[model samples]
Each structure stands twice: as structure tokens, then as C-alpha cells.
Target: MKHSEFDEEFDVIVIGVGAAGAAAALSAHERGASVLVVEKCPPKCAGGNTRVSGSGWFINSSPERAAVFLRALNGSRTVAEDVVQTWASETAKNSDWLADLGATARPTGAYHTEAEFSEVDGADCYAGMNTINGEMGQFLLYEFLVGALAERGIEIRFETRAQELTVVDGTVRGVRVEGPTGEATLGARGGVVLATGGFAANPEMVQDYLPLDEYVLWGSPHSTGDGHRMAQRVGADMWHMGNMMTITGIDVGDTTGLFLALWAGHDYMFIAPDGRRFTDETKGNRHGHVQRNGAEELFPLRPFHIVFDEKLRAAGPLSPTSAVLPVGWKLLMENFVWSTDNSVEVANGQIRRADTLRELAAAIGVDPDTLERSVHDYNAACDVGRDDHFGRDPETLAPVSEGPFYSLRVVPLLGWSDGGPRRDGHSRVLDTRGEVIEGLYAAGEASATYSWTKDGGFHIADALAFGRVSGAHAASRVAS
Candidate 1:
């Protein structure tokens, strides 16, 4: 713990250049603290989950109402009352805080305005506060934060990965980092903040903690539990390790996954491995959870195929066609645009097509009769103008009868995991015994306060709120 050999030093050291880390760095700098940010990914892949997110930031107009809604959303899984209170109160200041930073807000339609749990008590308190000129699944917010950091001359070490926290007698002293040049120890005079995000891209963590056997990742590839491991190594308590934000998407290879635009129209259906229609595919899927058997639960974990006809294929792009931002990681990172007609996917074998329904079933490795029966039932429901089984909207009951039928394989898309080092309301990392680890802090998805379900903009909201808290505290702390 007494590593006197330090290569560099800063008043505050922030890990991961995402929303939380950027906020922490900026807040620290505002307090006249010399801050350095370490990012695991290169400049091109840097920003963490914030860069790839839908860019929907929010502020709570009423903290009391937000508290009620957050409690309802959390249900049985709850944190300390003080922590929840701070979460609501601080989140309420997000709009004002962003405004102070010279960021302007704009409406982003229903997806950003509406609360994920509309039926919850404080749903009315949810107010969308997207950045001006921002769109769903864009880097405008991240860019804004980065630009602010540059304006302040904050030093950021890209491709530098934090390996471990150097603890000197129960207090974090510095960080041992491995960078492109090699490994070195960097001393933090005030504290270190871990905003390294969640472990969505880590397969082992996913298998051990999450219930999904296989799924496409819709989050940053750099989110491999770096902060989780470092925090745990320093005796940090982990909470909500099993909770996640899940959705459904199609894997188009090369790390490209597309979220189907179910809201676009209903000329297609999701057929499970059993060649049967399971849940209402058109229902508003709340982070992949649905009200089933009187409790919210995840959608069935199984491989699925989007069965559609030539009409839907020719309608337009299968994914969102009008998103100002790229909807998927590969598209955003690699600049791989999805074909307008979806013909490129079919030619690339990402989508299976056949002239006959039986041929389509065979191509997708499902029993022909079962697939045909499932499609027949769906078409019959369309004919009768009602979906008795899944209760899909009667207005979206367009039959998928025109040949040649197409099937695109898809799996659950994990947005992010909200589990890592437990942090107090002030965003200080807490030990296993609920004691603060001095000179150590955490924010964002890695140390999210939400125990169970999270709302639309809660992740970014938490990051900004707690990031500022940690930054201000770290900057004001007495340097040893």
C-alpha cells in the first residue's frame, strides 16, 4: 500500500470517460482541482455507454414524487432511505446543472418524455431534458462533456486501463494503471473515482450473475467489469449484481445488433425456438420486463426469429430508419449503415428467406408444421381483428401472408448492468461493512443506486448527479 514510486499525480483521478467520469472531472476542475481521466478505450471507442445510449437525459421536477416512483419501481429490492432521498433530490437538480454548464435542452418525443413505469406513483415527476440537437442513440451528450473537459484543459489518458487501487491502511492512495506505453502508478492527492461502467460485455460475469445464457450486447464493449473487479479487490460491497436493463434485438454479425422497430407497424411476429408465439411482441417492453403472473418478470429466455413477409421487407429498413443517431453499436462505432431495403442482410445470410413458409421454417431450423401453425394462428387473429392469445393491438394486426417469407434470428439485448462497488449518496465507495473507503468514489452504471428496475433516463441522471457529488467532495478533501 506504501508505493512511493509514483509516475504522475493529480488532485482527482477519474476512471472511464463516460457521462459520470466526465462529470466528475468537470466538477473537480470547477473546484480548482487538477484532474486526470483514464479511459480504457482509445479515443475512437472512448465514452463508455453514454456515447452509445439513446441520449435521453431527464430531471425530476418533484423529488417527493420521484422518491415514490423510484420506491415503487425498486419494489422489494431497496437501499437505505437516506440514499434514496439523496438520489431523488440530486437528480431533481440535473436540468439546472446542465443549464449552468451551457447545455441547452430539447424534447425527444414520447420515448424520452414518457416514464418507463407509467403506472408508478411518481411517473408524473419524470421530465425529459435531452441536450439540444441530440437524438436517440447519439453521442451529443458525451461530446458536450468531452468538449467541456477540453475547454478546462483536463488531462485524459486514453487507452489507459486502471488495474488496481492502491490502498494505504484502509484508504485508497492511488491507482496502478496499465497504458499503451506500459504500467505505472499514478497518485491521487484527493481521491479516485470509478465510473468504469457495468460488465455487459463480459461473458463470464454474465453467465455467473445474469440468467441469460446467450445474448447480443447493445452496450459498450469496454464495459467488462473493470471497476467491479477493482472495487471488489479493495473490499467494496457489490449490490444489484443480478439486475440489468434488457431488450430484444437482431444480431447482424460483426458485433452489430439491431433493435426491431415493433412500433413501426405489425407485419411480422417473433417466433420462439418452439415455433410458437410467446408474449405480446407489440407490447411496450419495459427494459425487457413484462407484467406476468401479477409480477414483473423478464421476457422468456430463448432464441427467436422475426418472421415477416415480402411486404414488410420492402416497407423500409427493418431497424429504425429515422434515428438521427445510429441505433446500434456497430453502426455507431464502425459506421456500418444498415441497408435501406434490408436486402444486404438477406444476402449476407443474416436474414433467411424462402419462397414457401415450409421452406422458410426449414431454413431457420424450425419444424415446418409448427412454424406454419404459429403463423396461421397469428394470421387468423388478424382476420378476426383480435389477438386473444397475446392481445396485440388490433390496429397493428396486419397479416404476414405474402411470400417469400423472411426470418431474422435475434436474441435478448442487454443494455447495461447496474452493479459494482456500493456507493453512498455522496458517491463514495462503501466497504463490505458499510464504511466509506476514504479517497475512493464511484458513479454511473458501475455504481448505480437503482436496486431493481430503472427508468428511461435514470442511468445518465444518476451518473451526472452522483458524479458531481463525488467530484465536489474529492476536490474539497484535504490532500495528504
Candidate 2:
């Protein structure tokens, strides 16, 4: 069981090879450390989540435009100002690094449209991506990054499943990986980095860790939280246990339930536990259909409906083949994206189209009078380019003119959200007692207390950023 003698110890050992792990490994290797990147799946499998998301500098970021975004993200939360500064400073280098590794970063403006940008520095600029399937933006992203690392003389052992960590004297020394040939002891001379992703892939863990239905994660099966479990087993501090995410995608049907085509957006609604409409789809500071049931905030709608007009449907939201998911494609296609068609109404849980507004509300099972009044208020505003109630999309309104209007029930989909285990600006994983867990580092979805989930954009970007920082930091510890 002890392979400290025959074990192939390296200066640094990185687990997982996605965006975070890849960045970490590259940074460590560039620093003159001999590295071993262990991946359970081959190149294709490791592509995981980053392989499919939209193209853009998420969290509404840019070197010139970050301060406001960061402050807005921090809000009342206990975020390290210095860490925000570091993430802003290093993003460009990371961008360039990614470009060098064959990943092309295109620019998508921070605002959805140029109309929303403020004329100020230290502000967030919108930049989007154009990643692809064979484009190395696809499954090949892992392949390209890994190849770049190997060319640098870093040892990459593929098909290696790292099952356990070997700790000595309270610090992690290395890991025990089981490969196809046989089990091998891979020791880390300095430290071990767990860039292994989230528990979205594991239904069991989904039940144990999250409060929502286990169907929230629309990511990879390989991201079954092996790293989370292993880290927790060794007493690694879990900062944002409540911060795990549950994404709501279009529930296609019985067989193909939750079809996640990023290019084909999910125009679904966020309904309350009781069937009722809440927030206007086009309104809100953050932009994910699934998030939380705010305990303190007093809002009329708990779960928001993401309805679209007949005009939206005709736009022909992009398909699964495109690089970007058109934001509302899925809901549009499923008639779940608000419509006035009988066919779509029939398909959406037997929603009925009313010859009159009262009849329509009754068919959908919502408050008939309240629903009619809401419709009247919404239509009056739609005629002009303004939403009086919630200040929704001023320009993108189309009256529910065509009849037998349909509405699908919506509900808040929650991911987990934990509130403790603070870290410094460096993103070091801390212990239960609020001290750094020396030689051990955590990133990606694994460390969430510092995440700027005030909106959906920062959650991912931070995950990617910290993933890199933790990896490089772990590698640095290996040399001394």
C-alpha cells in the first residue's frame, strides 16, 4: 500500500485537465517545475463543462472594466479586495496564455448590446468567445492545452483515475491513482492540486449536497465530485457548500429530458412551488433562469417565467451546431418560451388558449383576474418601448397579440450555497479553523465562498480564474 519508495514523485501533480487544471499545470511547468497531470478520462472526456458554454469574458469583465463589476459582486459578502484586484490583473496574461495554447479568445462586449455600456474606466467591458467543437474550443480544448504542456516536458499520464490522497504529518504528499495497467503511487514532492470539477454529475451527491431536485446540473458526468469527496474526506474546508449550482434548461420530453445545447438557449420560466408568474423574464440584474428563492428579498415572483413572443420564435434561435447558444432557443422551440399558438399551448402541459383573457388564465390555472390584469399592464407597456412594472426590455417587446396565449409553469431551481471558509486574495483553500490548509489548494466550483454569484457571469469566470491561481500556487509549494 506504501509506494513512497517505488512511487514516481513529481514537483507538482495536477488532477483534472479542464480550463482550470490546464491553466494551473501550464503555470507550474513554466515556473520550472516538473509536473504530472493526472486525468481519469482521455482528452475528449475531460472537455466536460467548459467545452460547451457561451463565448464571452464572463462576469462582465475586462482589464479596464472590472472595479464596478467586482464591487457589485462583493456587495455585502466578505470578499477580499486584493483578490479581486489580482483576478483583474492576471486575466490578460491568462487570456494570452490560452491563446498561445491554441484557444482563440474573441471579444464580445460586456453589455448585451452597445447601448448598455457606461463611459467609465475600471468598468467591465463585454467580450464574448467563438469557441467551437473541432475548433479546439470544443472537445479539442483539453487536447490542445494538454499537448502544449507535454511539449514543455511535463509528464501527462492519461486514463489515470486518482482515487485517494496520501497524507503524511498532516500535509498531503501525493495521490494514489489506478490506471489501466495497474495501480501506481504518484507522489507530489511539493503539494497536490485538485482542479477536479463539481458534483453536478453525481446524482447521489446531488441528493446529499443540494436542496433542489437532483436534475439541476446540466454539465458533465465525469464531474461527479471525486475531488470534492477526496478533499472533504481529508478535512479540506468547504467554503460555499450552499453555493453549488442548479441550472434550468429546457425539459424537452420524457426521453430527452433537459437537452442542454448552449447554442439553443432555454427560454423556460422560473415558476414558484405554487404555479404562478413572478419576475419578468427580460428584467433582473443577473441572467440565469435558475438560482434561488430569496429568503429576505420581498419580490412578487419567486420563480420567474421566461416567456418569448411569436416574433422571438421566428428569429430561429441557433441550433446545437452553433458556437453560441442563442439565449432563448430551447424555450422558443418548445412553445415554453411564451407563445400565442394553439399547438404550442396544447404541448405545454395542456395549457389552454383563451378566446378572452379571463378564459386563458383559467386554462393555465393561475389567478384569472390577476393574470388578465398583468397581461393588460404588460401589453400597454409593450406598445411603447418601456416596461413600467419591472423596467424590462425597453426595445425587445412584442405584445402577446396572437391568441390562445400559452404559459408554462415556472419555479426557482437552486444549486447549493454555503457561506463560510474564507480565503485570502490568493485563493488558498483554508481549514475548518479558518487557517490555510498548507500544501493543499482548491478552485473551480470547489471553492465558492469567494464567488461573485451576485450574477451568473462572475461565478464561472472566478471558478476558472481561481482554478489557475490555485494550481500555480500548489506548484510553487512543490519546489521548496
Candidate 3:
């Protein structure tokens, strides 16, 4: 459908009102360019994944340490040397830049401190990283950005979705948008910045790219890969479309409920549908537990269940509310329940319970004999204080022999996709033949910055760093 041209034009048009889009608009406006930020979701749900995230900042005190850590994290699939160097250097100074914008940095727990490198099993990637705790978590950080944008007179049209990029001659001109009113093409003299996030919320994209059976998206529902499809339509190159930062947890039966199963911790054992322990369960909550059996086997642990006795349930909250939620918020406020006791969940059929391992297996639709054998073997390992199959810590090992066993089906909870249109260090989108697409830029998860998983803060850092770069370069073109 052809759309009429917008009456008013701006120097820069930023797509998606997430962290990257917010930063891009702010940066462009700060550089004396009239900016317009368009968001698909309404103002209430505007911040995308950045608002629900833990809002940690992975800052290095020194650029040298930052480079070494990034090099190790991005093993074979390395980013360009100059890009890596720029990211490393800029991330060190990003904390101050963010602080100047009214966001404060602090240590998250104890691990996110400025420390020397120490090797853990799978957690060695975060060496010299710290976190940013706003005055009131991610909410305040997002509020600050929104407030800043409003103060600068940058118009953020909520409920306005960028449909396509409008190009003229060889230069990208602006974006065609569908808003609450109607469809129109908003012209941009500088360029259009795509900060539209990833495709984790799209099931078809997840099935085609990521190796998972049925994944639950824990991030923003607004991220439906709009920017990715739009960029591809313009001959932009893509990379690392298969990589994702995923975590394992039980589905609380609600489609939007992504509760991290505390039972997946050291206290319980994860058994596949065939009733066998696949991977070590002691590693932290962020580690992906989906195992691949062979070249043909994609997801060997689909419909995997966590087995635990009554003791673990009585210990404390089985599944804490998301860190994004404020303290003292009612557990029952949402559609799903979050509590230590599994009785409510069991009664609701979100969690299954049985008097015996055989009965439990039957209830959850797995082979009873195999499930019994798997439990017996795991209990035997607990008795001997040694995990032969998977080297799980002895301290977290607890026998599941007690009656009234409980099991909940768990699946991979996707945080975000680490893939999209490839961009240069200057934040200009590159095409298939490695040529820059003039007047087109991308940042945040919309661009393939961190192809491999690092820590939490790297995403936000990439958005801030490249958002500034993209905004500055785009505005510079307008000035010239």
C-alpha cells in the first residue's frame, strides 16, 4: 500500500524506543539535529528488553583488560580488531557518560567487581566487569532516558511502527511508518537508525535459526525482528543469526510467564524425556542446558523436567520473581504464581507430583522404568558424593528418593538474539559485498555486535557506544 509523505521531516529518525533507540535519538539531538524516535509498542511498554533486564553494566577499569576479556569471550567468531578495540575503549568510559546522563553504576552482588581473572568452569567470561544499579533498578534508568528525550524536545511517536526504509537514488532517505493515525513516510535528511532489537519473540525465526524445540521468550514481545527483515530487504548482510543468550527454566503454563526454576539449581536434577541426566545442573542460572546428542539430533532435551523432593521446596522460594520487578511486589500480582511452596502450582497442574518415580514419569509423559533407573543412579551418586556422569558439585547434590516427588517441564528461556544486520565500527550497515549502505545505521541487538555471548552489560554498552557513533556520523552528514 502506498503511503502519503509526512508533512514534517526531521534530520534523524530512530526506530524502536529501546536503549539503543533512546541513545541514538539523544545523541543526535545533542549534536543539534532534529530527531524523531518511533516505537512500535505503546508508551507503557516502550523500553523493550532494557526495562526488564537486570541493568548490569560490564565496565573495565582498564582498556587492556577489556580487550583481553573480549578476545577470550569472542573465540573463533571474533569481531573486527578495530571494532573490538573501539568497544573495549569506549565501554570503559561509558559508565561516566551514563552517569552524566543521571544513571549511577554500582557492583552487582560480589562477582561484578574489579578483580583479576579467575577461572571458573563456564563463568570466566566476566573478568573485569561491574554492574550499574540505578536509583531504582532498570525502571529508573529507562525513565531517565525518556525524561531526557522529552526535555530535549525529541518527539517519540509511540504506537508508530517503522514499516520500511524509503530510499532515493543511492542514499537512504527515511522510513515508512504506520502510526495510530495512518501510514506515512517520514523523511530524514541525515539517516534512519534501526534499533529494533532481535527475533526471540518470533517462534518461526527461533525454530529456523536457533537449536531449540519450543523456546519461551523472556525478553520484550515487541522484538519481532522487524529491523532484521527491513534491513535484509535493502541488501544488508547478516551474521550470527544462530547465536542467542538463552537460560533454562520451567514454563509456568502462562505463555508470558518465564519464571526461572530455582529447582534447576544445585539441589535438583534435570532429566531429559528419555529419563537421563544430560548436563551439569550446578552451573549458574544463565547457562544453557539444552544438549545436542549427535549431528542429526537438534534438541535432545526437549520437554526436560526437573526432579526434586519436598525438602528443596521447603527451603525457600523455589522461583524468585524477576530481578526487574521491584521488591515487596506481590507474587500473585501477575498471571503466574511465584513462591517457595509447590503445593499451589501442583494443584494448578503447572507442576506435577507423584508418590513414586514411576508414577511421576507417567504423569509427565516419560518412560517410568527409565525415569526410575535415572533417579536411582543419581541418588547413588549423591550417596557417594561424586557425580560420575556429569561433574556436578557435591554440595548441591540432594537425594530425590523421598516420596511425593515433584516434576516440572522446563524449556530454554531466550533473553535476546545476538544476531542481525552487520555494521562497521562507525555503526554504518554493511551489505553483502562488504560495502556500506549509505545513510543506513544500526545499533543494539538490531546489529551483529556481540555475535557470541558475553555478560549482561555488554548489550547495553554496545547500544550506548554505537548509538552515539551512529547518531554523530548521521548528524555530521547533515552538517556537511
Predictions in order: lDDT:
0.83, 0.53, 0.73
lDDT of 1: 0.83
Candidate closer to the true structure by lDDT (higher is better), 1 or 2: 1
lDDT of 2 by residue, 347-380 (tens): 5553333467566556555666666666666677
The TM-scores, one per candidate, come to 0.94, 0.73, 0.90
- Measured with C-alpha atoms, the lDDT of residue 228 in candidate 3 is 91
RMSD of each: 2.3, 6.0, 4.0
Query: What would the per-residue lDDT of candidate 1 be over residues 382-418, giving only the tens digit for each residue?
Result: 9999999988889889999999999998787788888
Kindly provide the TM-score of model 1 when superposed on the true structure, using C-alpha atoms. Answer: 0.94
**RMSD in angstroms, candidate 1?**
2.3
Instruction: Using TM-score as the measure, name the better of candidate 2 and candidate 3.
Output: 3
Model 1 spans with C-alpha error above 4 angstroms: 1-5, 321-325
Q: By lDDT, who's the top model here?
A: 1
Tens digits of per-residue lDDT for model 3 on 194-263?
9998887887887888887776666677678999999999999998788776665556554444645574
